[model samples]
Target: MHRTVFNHGIKLLKPTQRCIPVAVLPTRQSLLLYISNHSLQNRNVSIKTELSGTNVAQPKDANNVAHKQEAPWDIDFTNIVEAYKSKSNYEIFRAAMVFQLCTIGFLVEHGMTISKYMKKVTGKWLFKKSMNMSFYGHFVAGENQDEIRGVVDKLSAHGVGAILDYAVEEDLSEEKAEKLEMDSCKSNVTPEYETMDRYQPHREFSDRRKKVVSARTYFYEGEAKCDDNMNIFLKCIDAVGATTDGGFAAVKLTALGRPQFLLQFSEVLSKGQKLFERFCGKEGNLVDRKFDQLRFETKAAKLGILMSRDESQKWFTWMDRDDSGYVDLLDWNEMIAKHRKFSDLFVVLNPETGDEESLLPKFTDEEEAQMKRMLIRVDALAQRALEKNVRLMIDAEQTYFQPAISRIVMEMMRKFNRKKTVIMNTYQCYLKSAEDNLCTDLALSQREGFHFGLKLVRGAYMEHERERAKQLSYDDPIQPSYEDTNRNYNKLLKIMLEHIKQGGKADVMFASHNEDSVKYALSTIHDLELTPQMQHQVYFGQLLGMCDHITFPLGQAGHRVFKYVPFGPVDEVLPYLHRRAQENRSVLSGSSLERSMLWRELRRRLFKGQIFYKPT
Candidate 1:
């Protein structure tokens, strides 16, 4: 029966599960044949059910189960000449050279250190020029909007959209923050930002841990620098809107405020959420099942909150939205999300005093003002994106910072995503709690009556996250192995795709460089029978100067695709460049498919006696 289905280019399934046609594209036949002829005949497939909308075939026989369901279609990445035909010979040559260097494990791993040493030996002037002609030229779009316009237009010409990123990030370590604090005290210098008139002076009620850890080193100077980043993002939004309809503007939340504040903020939420979870026992919806103000207060106070009846009543009254004297998950989420509204609700215990207090009350007047300023900047950027019809995608950072990032981005979505999915959050699938994160956010969006927007990526901060966990004596946040990450990525992909198939108000960008993941996404989309117009909400993305084989074919095949066009001054974007090189080293070094394809294309060009041939 499976063989018959394969012979015909029509859909056939077990009537219980909606399987896509077994037909393989001409380019994918070899791969399809290898899997089908060797694996599928023996196993009986069963669809696994879960709370989240994830459904995949599970074989009854445990052995070799993973091998039975390779996607039946693939994008032909081997057509290297066709993919490179759109690029100039010089561009291709430079990319080939850059990727060739990326193939060297030692160089990629130590690229930043080596570049710094080279700069010292070569002098800054010569170093800048050389970098501009090589790595910088290949990876980044340009330094400013006027320069970036050409890159956008070129990508648009090839049916690919552009995601403009102003590659400036701000992160300060604890040691650096302490140093700055000492330096400022020695100089007797006032902070760069002035205090707002409405806020009170630094108070004693804020959680003690925050005051001790983040008070002096919270990037007070960055108050002004954050404003600069906001302006750059505004310009990026304009550039995307002007150049292409429905383009994307990539914004990093860490770039907008102090990293320590975010870390502290995340810590507060993390603890609060765990307490909430415990308060909602077995079924997870205790607040909704029965409505009692005293019960709620008793539960909270027993769980370490020192709220009096009157104090807890303010929360109960506010959270009981329908005025029925009952709070549901949605109602609780609504109140918790407005962190500024209920200061007592967003609290952490004072480590020294062992008493609960809000993070806000402890803030110095300047710190409170700084928090407002950061929100204002984020609001302005989101407003500009909405006005410009640009999708604003917030990039995911480290786990310590991610909870706060997700929290704020969701707040933006509740506001701007009412009519359209203008604000999008990122999900890093490599995390241990990836599915839970996705399910929670998806549920919130549904309950709040807003569009859910997301971008999925296998995380980039693997080494940093692992090392930090080891040093801090905590459980590692990253998945144990590469295969685990891939499985999580695909599972999350299925959940979102199924949501779209069911006509849920959601949008997702399947941003990845992994070919198998990409093929699986495409296959799932086809199975769901989404038309090209419906696919406007779906997207694929790869970085500029990397994975042209995937990006170009995706564009040429008429799917909605985008290149992450990072732009900044050469010196400013070094960190981003280094990460780009280092993170992709596995794909570029030893037995890398991309390098082999580049080599194949280079060989073809050489044999044709057009090694340096410039495309007309």
Candidate 2:
């Protein structure tokens, strides 16, 4: 009754057995192997290897057994979720938490009183402590490595690993943060979470997790004392283990607000608030010349402001270093995004829908000066990231701050991305201009001979951006509708992959919680016949706890998957946490599959009478 298994780990199938895929199985697939006509005594067996991520079949060379790539769905998530299900009421607690998140997200997204109410209530200690154990604990890794390690191990068991999201802030330390945030109004940056002490993990525990996990890093710029803040976050990693973990690291340009006075700057800059006007020396002098020209042409149309490029591609071309035959949309949009950021470009737009647009005159001398200073700091961050052999990602801020962020990221990429893509730029596809902007970036990469590392997300500031546009009576900068945004996301992904396929160098991270987007990415790679090496250039990302169903299976199938693993004190990371809640309401609602999937998983586990763990 013994069945024969080949030396290459291919199992011999019974003559009457039909092949079934692991994806369709609610449980682990028991290797549906079928043997072909080959001499058994000759010790060579031929088996067709056409399995997909789930159960679908694809054609491949039958003999190349040593180098097989499993489809993303080959990993069974029932056991994965069940293991985490063993962790303290993980399922039911999260279900309730997600409901709360959806409610909050709906209110915030819709511009209701709940957003304001939530913010006010977050200031209370009881509310703060309660959320830390529930929502925060679910999403963020521990404030320290011990807690982080536990969560990391749990995630790895399911094939999804972690990326630490560390935000720098206005205060120098936890002591200052406590006084500045908790004691006063709401903490501009809140909570003392990361235990920054030079602590070591137990050798025993270290050895155990070494097999299970690696970590990616996120640099969230705060302000002031950037060098110090950078040192703090960078040092937190157990460098030796991280190198072995096989994930990327990051550097955030906008988060490091004031290098010298970084926190002071970031404190004011949070939520897109502007600091006081500053003197801008030479840049200001040049802007004034443009201003005079603009005023002469437009007859004081902008009401005390002037813009030379109101009707010109001349300025656009001047910024297009690659001469891609089109303006550097990144720079062009940044100008528009920044103007909107500073004083609402929507305000200056004619409600008459005249189709003429205006931009803010250049920055004040001091503001321009700050950018120079910030670049200096950004260079240091990029250099350090290079030395650490880690990838740096510049977070995409609001349009107001994005130009500076984009400028910093481009410089970092040019300087460091010469050999490999150590620096990545995040592109928000929700904006109509993003695809053209990315194309400009692609041209920059080609011209400069650098691999463009890009992170694509649907976008975060839809509500704020739209509300302001409506308030200011300008056409919104976002895509006209959600369908448009999704279309842009899928199209940009296709464009990015095609760039890599055509031998244009690129690295991309598709960060989304949407199931269709995830499937589309995998299917595109499969259809394009992107080799395994090329596929590595593409990675899938989800916020930890938001899309485990997608990330876990993808990770298990040996696909590169990353989870945004946030680590910070309760109060400090609260704003980010709140935003995640809102994002899910929008992202997870389309098909109602998010809820159905969770309920199915929960009921299955409950029926199994699995061991239950309590939520913290």
Candidate 3:
């Protein structure tokens, strides 16, 4: 009966319209006759074929073509039954129900907010209960430090790790603000003050006041309050350390100081040679023997000139003593030394610590003492973070301040990274130079023989960075297109993976919402023939409440994964939440691919009649 059915099916098939032999059927006489007849018919059809070459003959075997077309979606019922035989049907059903519920809950909560925010910039109404539930359930493990442990344990059971961020909002205060300023000076002695002063309405007074204020006051009483908060931050790290094996923490550069200040300091250091030439009337070479000797012999004389109440008076006095083309070397040296000392003093003082009197024409000796005290406090904070084994992931801020923070954190990493990845640097993929910067950093890590920890982020400060560049008539640092940034990110990831695979000293965490990048990393690992355990070298990170498709599956498959859970007081976290909502809305609406996946998941659940909710 089966043979008869097969024969009937084959008989229903047709030859091409051009009479090309579609199949070589066996004749009653012999197979050789069938081949000869088929070949001759095909040859004739080829010769008579249209010369335009637009249409090509398609397969004429209806049964074969149907099977070929259906192969992709065809299911083996026997294999499906065997796959489920090992497990109870109820258990399978329950698991499926849970998965659907979680997915639906996630979409409804975040999707609405994303939709609303995408439509309106000032859309406050989107912050509804569903949104909070989605963010809290999917993104946040717990509200405070204590609540994270249960979540951590559950995730660990599923082979996922967590990254804890103590998301504190900036609080402006006279005392705390001043301490932050002073501590910044001690950690980084760049001429940031001068650059920042240039843009301010009261540049001269601000500059003068910063010079006069004591470094200790800047550290202890002013902006240093933010640094002091580090003590509490370290405690949270300790908690995570005790709870989970692969947990990490994060910090921000702005938490330390303003970007303008650091940029100013970098500019001054960069232009040191030019400034030195201007200070010396002639293009005197300090490297020359005569210049060196002159500088050495008249050090006190230079100080005396600088100390003189009037520079004009001192010049006239020098002219009276000796008639020469220029002021005597002795007077010039004295003036230069005094000027140098004053500049040095200005660089050391904390701008934020000054009282009304300190901001006066000149800073008193007492204010200088205050600046020194602030430095000690900052050092203490660094010491605490190191002692606790708390890995500090320093977030990238504006380009201006990033260098200053990098220097400080790199120093800390050198000191503390010996034990573990204590300091992690973040690269903003949107920046054109970020990839180059990362490569340079990797080279430095190789040369220094220290473990390099890096966090790759798409970037957070795009609008601000671009606007500032436009206003200043400078080239924008961001990538020209999204594809460019993704390409760079993947390249960096490959570099990181290579470093890890070789057991070279580097740790990488990919923080992205783009599913393609995540899939690429996974595929790369598989192509490299590395097992899941060995592939733990690469960590997949996503912001809380975004891209569960990548995160959950990789996590379930035993790959190390992390959610960037940010927590702080409600008011402090509002800005961060707002940004999160904006990003979700932008990502969801921007791509039809994402929208389709979301709809697919939604349909799958609805079709199964398993969309009913249960209490968490």
Which of 1 and 2 is ahead in lDDT? 1
> What is the C-alpha lDDT profile of model 3 across 327-351, one tens digit per residue?
3333332222222222321122342
Candidate 2 shows a clash count of: 28
Stretches of candidate 1 off by over 4 Å are 1-73, 88-90, 109-133, 142-151, 168-220, 282-329, 339-367, 568-572, 587-591, 609-616
Per-residue alpha-carbon lDDT of candidate 1 for residues 433-487, written as tens digits (9 for 90 to 100) = 7887788788878877899999999987776667656765678889999999999
TM-score-best of 1 and 2: 1
Off by over 4 Å in 3: 1-154, 166-221, 258-261, 268-382, 527-534, 568-572, 587-599, 611-616
What TM-score would you give candidate 2 relative to the actual structure?
0.60
Worst 10 contiguous positions by lDDT, candidate 3: 25-34
Q: Cα RMSD (Å) per model?
A: 17.8, 21.2, 28.8
> Model 1 — which ten-residue stretch has the worst lDDT?
25-34
Sort by lDDT, best first: 1, 2, 3
